[model samples]
Target: MDNWNILLESTNDGFTIATVLEVPDCQIRDETKEGAVEKVQQLLQKRLDKAEIIKIPTPIQPSTLENPVMRFAGIFRDDPDFIEIMKEIRAEREQDSDL
Candidate 1:
């Protein structure tokens, strides 16, 4: 299992995060939470061709200081867990087709 570190920063407009995937050479910085996850997936797919390795990244916990509207936007639009779950289901269905 490989672990990745991520940080979420707040701005006047919205929130963004940078994912520290690799040390220096192969790190990916995804501004948004969901984007960071997609970036990690892309990195792994590039590095490892077909080996199944469990990947865990530090989640971007929401901040209470953020505006309610911004927080709501983050909750509904940038929910990485929700997106990932859908992706897993889609992938499972695709694999089942080959059986």
Candidate 2:
């Protein structure tokens, strides 16, 4: 059996809603959280009974040598001021967030 996470929520009408995480359509509403979760689980199980996840081999290279960004890959590696620049950037971000 494939393990799936369940999200539970209380409805305004006193019913409990249970949704299978990552699957917006796999949901159910019931009088109790357990009942709602059980219904959603059954629904998900039935839907995925004949379904599966598979990987496909690809010829694409993530960081190809011909890519333009590769030219800047190690340009800052030898910069002595890079550490101070990163520290200044972090301090600026924290200051902005404080506002």
Candidate 3:
């Protein structure tokens, strides 16, 4: 999962700031807050679609070598603790499925 750090600043109309990818240097922004968000979503979707069609470079891994979540946690995926929590939940689900 990809996450962005959105810095909203109050303006005459509303808030505004650049939406940057937490991992890579990719970023985009719009004058309008809502419009900026929508545009970013659209841009992300386009990139995702294009990524599906092209060969992209793999992201860097974390120091921990548990799973992909741990490998890229806090960088590409998200918070390490949250990722581990989700992993535990998934494990429970899989275990429940077998029963």
Candidate 2 to native Cα RMSD, angstroms = 8.6
Winning candidate number (lDDT): 2
Model 2 scores worst on lDDT over the 10 consecutive residues at 60-69
Q: What is the descending lDDT order?
A: 2, 3, 1
**Ranking, TM-score, top scorer first:** 2, 3, 1
TM-score, candidate number 3: 0.35
Model 1: lDDT of residue 28: 49
Q: After superposition, how far is residue 55 of candidate 3 from its true place, in Å?
A: 14
User: Given candidate 1, what's the lDDT at residue 16?
Assistant: 48
**Candidate 2 lDDT by residue in tens digits, 1-99:** 557888899989999999888788888999998889888988898888877878999787766648787778988887879978988999999999999
RMSD after Cα superposition, model 3: 15.6
lDDT of 3 at 97: 100
Q: Which digits, one per residue and each the tens of the lDDT, describe model 3 over residues 19-52? A: 5545243445567778777766676667677665
Off by over 4 Å in 3: 1-15, 52-99
TM-score of each: 0.29, 0.55, 0.35
Using TM-score as the measure, which candidate wins? 2
Q: Cα deviation in Å at residue 41, candidate 3? A: 0.5
